[model samples]
Target: MNRLRANDWLFWGSVLACYLLQLMPLPQALLPLKPWWLALVLMYWILEAPDYVSLGRAFVLGLVGDVLAGELLGEQALRLCVACFILMRFRARLRFFPMWQQALAALALLANDRIVLFAIRAVSGEAAVPASYWLAPLTGMIAWPWVFLLLDDARARARVRES
Candidate 1:
């Protein structure tokens, strides 16, 4: 309802901030450590606001990510749609998983997403990927718990405000 709508806005707004963080200029040495913020944010919404983020919304957001990052066309959109689809399909079990398990699952999801990107790059005959491509997901995994806790706290506050 209205409360959920308000919360959804908060979620999307935070996701936007994450994208900005992702795009912030940084030295090459630190780039691999940049967590996949958009994926984490989207996964949270997919878990916490399933009714708010659907396949269509995921697709659109992914398209924007693709354009923003200047990646191959449709690569991110497809990966995002697939990730969101899996998250939506398994959300019931995902929601009940312990925080450690949830972080593990998020790591797997991020790794899979990266693999998909690699596959797309290979298919497109892009340059060889460095071993560093694996680093982002690890960083993302490490960041998942923190991101989840922060978002959960934000959502709780939003819920309280609504009530």
Candidate 2:
């Protein structure tokens, strides 16, 4: 029970951290390179602990992210729901893949996220995004292994402490 509680704390703490990262300011040159931190973090959770992350939760998180980033009210929510749905649908296969394979899958997911965002903006009459807008998913792909390892290590430590 204690271990479960600790895991809960860790999950929320990581979510908070991802939100902070999303809100962090960056130079104009690097802004487009910023990966979707919340999406990546939520993907990790959805893949590792499906019971704890659902489509509704993803929608809520994306709504919060939309407010934080000052995007359209439902834009992030829609994007996140789509991403979560895909992840949940393929969780079984994704969970069993090697780390490198998982990272590739992450790349595909992030790219799909970009497509969703594009559709949302298009429907909303937003101006065309620059080529750089696509770079974040590549960066996310690069970061996936590190993010997975870091979170896995943290979870392991929490379990160890409980033991």
Give me the candidate number with maximum lDDT.
2
lDDT of 2: 0.89
Clashes of each: 0, 0
Write the residue-wise lDDT of candidate 2 on 45-142 in tens digits: 98887777888988998898889889889888998899899999999999999999999998999999998888878988995999999999999999
Q: What is the C-alpha RMSD of each candidate to the true structure, in Å?
A: 1.4, 0.9
* Cα-based TM-score, every candidate: 0.93, 0.97
- Off by more than 4 A, model 2: none
- Candidate 1, position 136, lDDT: 87
Tell me the deviation in Å of residue 161 in model 1. 1.7
- Pairs that collide, model 1: none
